[model samples]
Target: MTTTPARERTRHEIVRQAMGLFQDRGYSAVSLQDIASAAGCSKATVLYHFNGKAAVLAAVLEPAAADLAALVAAADQLSRAAAQEFAIGEFTDLAVRYRGVMDVVQELIPFIQEMPELALLVADGIRLKGFLAGSDDPLEQDLAGFALNGLTAECRHADGRTDEELHRLCEAALNRLFRPS
Candidate 1:
C-alpha cells in the first residue's frame, strides 16, 4: 500500500533528521531515538516510516548513489580526456554539494564491499575497463585514483568557494598528476 501525504511527509522528515545525525555523528553512533527526537516525532513513528536504521542509511545514500551511477554512465560515452574531466571534476563537485553526507561516505568507504549500492557507485571508478575505450596506462590509472581520493578527503566544507572554483582546482591537480615525466 502507498503512504498517505501526511505519512510521506513524516517519512521524509525522519530521513532528513537521520541523515543529519548520521553526518554529524557516524552512523554507528546514531540511534533511532535520536532521529525521532531530532525530527520531533516518536520512536514508533520513526519505525513506522523506516524498518530500521539501515533503511534510513539507504534512503540517505540514494541521491549520491544515483548521481554517481549517472556520472559513471555518462563517462562511458567518452574516453580518456573526457572521462577524466567528467569523473574527477563532477565527483569533486558532488563532494562539495553533499557536504553533510561526505563525512558519512568517508566513513563508509572502507566497508563499501559490504554495501552493494556504494560498490555500484564506485564500481567503474573511472577505469571503465572492458566497458569502452579502457586505458591500460598505469600512470593514467594511478593519477585518476589518486585525484579521486585526494579531492574527496581534502574538501568537504566548501563554504567560501564556488563549484567552478573547486572544479578548476581539481582540474589543475589532475593536469599535474597526468603530466608526463
Candidate 2:
C-alpha cells in the first residue's frame, strides 16, 4: 500500500512507534494493539494506515534497506581499509539515525536466514548480507563477520559507550575482519 502525502505524518508516527515497540519487545512480541497504544491511536487507525503488522514492518524496514544499498554503492571505490572504515562508519551512523531500527533488523536475522527468498531480498535489497563484499580483502566477502555490528547494536544501549565508542568498535571489528591472514 502507498502512503499519501497528507497521511504521511500519521504513517510516520505509526512506523516510528512500531519501531520502538519492536526494539523494546521482540518483533513477534509486539501486537497491533501494543503499537496502537504506544502510538496513542486505535488499532483500527493503524490498520487503516497499514494493512497489518507485516506492512508496518515493511514500511519501517524499507528505508533502512535502501540505506544499506547506498552504503554498498558508496563503498565501491575505496581501498580495503578505506572501504572497511567507510562501511563501519556508515553502518554505525545508520544505527544511530534509525532510532532502534537496528534492533528490528537484527531480530529479523533468524527469519531471513530461514527463508531463502527473504534472505535474498535482504542480501540484494538490504546489502547487509555482504556489508563489505567489494572490499579488497577476501575476509570481507563473508557476511558472518558483520554479526559483530549486530552485537554492538544490541549492547550499545549500555552505559559508557558513546557514539564515538560504537564507531570505534565497529571500525576495529572491520579491521579485525580484514586483518592479514
Candidate 3:
C-alpha cells in the first residue's frame, strides 16, 4: 500500500531529521527516539516510517549518492578540463558531507556481499569512474575511481592543507591517472 500525503510528509520529516542527527553523531550513536524528538513526533512514528537504523542509514546515503550523480552528470556540460575539476570538487564535497558515514561504508563493505540494494547505492558512485579520459578502458576507469577515492580521503583528512593545495593535489592525481602513456 502507498502512503498518504500526510504519512509521506511524516516519513520525509523523519528521514530529514535523521540525516542531521546521523551526520552529527554517526550511525552507531543515534537512536529512534532521537530522530522522533528531532522531528517533533513520537518514537512510534519514527519506527513506522523506518524499520530500524539501517534503513535510516540507507536513506541518508541516498541523497548523497543522488547529489554526486547530479554533479557528475552536470560535468558533461563543461570543457574537459573544467569537467575534471568539477569531478574532483564533487568528490571532495561527498567526502566532506559524509565524513561521519565513512566508517559505516567501510564496515559494510564486506557484508554487502549479500545486500544488493545497499550495494547498488554504492554502485551509483562508480559512475564517477567515467570522469577519466581513458574511461573507455574499464580497468583504467576502475583504477581512476580508486585513486580519486583515495584523494578524497586525503582531502578530508588533510591537516592544515589549504583548499587550493588540496584541490591541486586532487587535480594532479586525476591528471596522473588519465595521462597518456
Q: TM-score: which candidate is best?
A: 1
List the global CA lDDT of all models: 0.70, 0.67, 0.68
How would you encode candidate 2's per-residue C-alpha lDDT over 14-107 as one tens digit per residue? 9989988888898899999998998888899999998888778877777876777688777766665576567766766766666466667677
lDDT of 3 by residue, 1-181 (tens): 9757998888888888887776567555789889889999999887787777777777766776677768767877887667666776676566555554553464455454455546656655665666654356768767876785576557546677776666667666666666644
lDDT of 3 at 79: 73
Tens-place lDDT per residue, model 1, 1-181, is: 9757988888888888888899788888999999999999999988887778777787887788778777778887886667755665666667677767766777776776676545565575444322222356666566556666666665555556676776677657755665334
Q: What is the lDDT of candidate 2?
A: 0.67
Q: How far in Å is the alpha carbon of 172 misplaced in model 1?
A: 1.9
Which candidate order results from sorting by lDDT in descending order? 1, 3, 2
Question: So what's the TM-score on candidate 2?
Answer: 0.72
- In model 2, residue pairs whose N, Cα or C atoms come closer than 3 Å (at least 3 residues apart or on different chains), thus clashing, are none
Q: How many steric overlaps are in each model, in order? A: 0, 0, 0
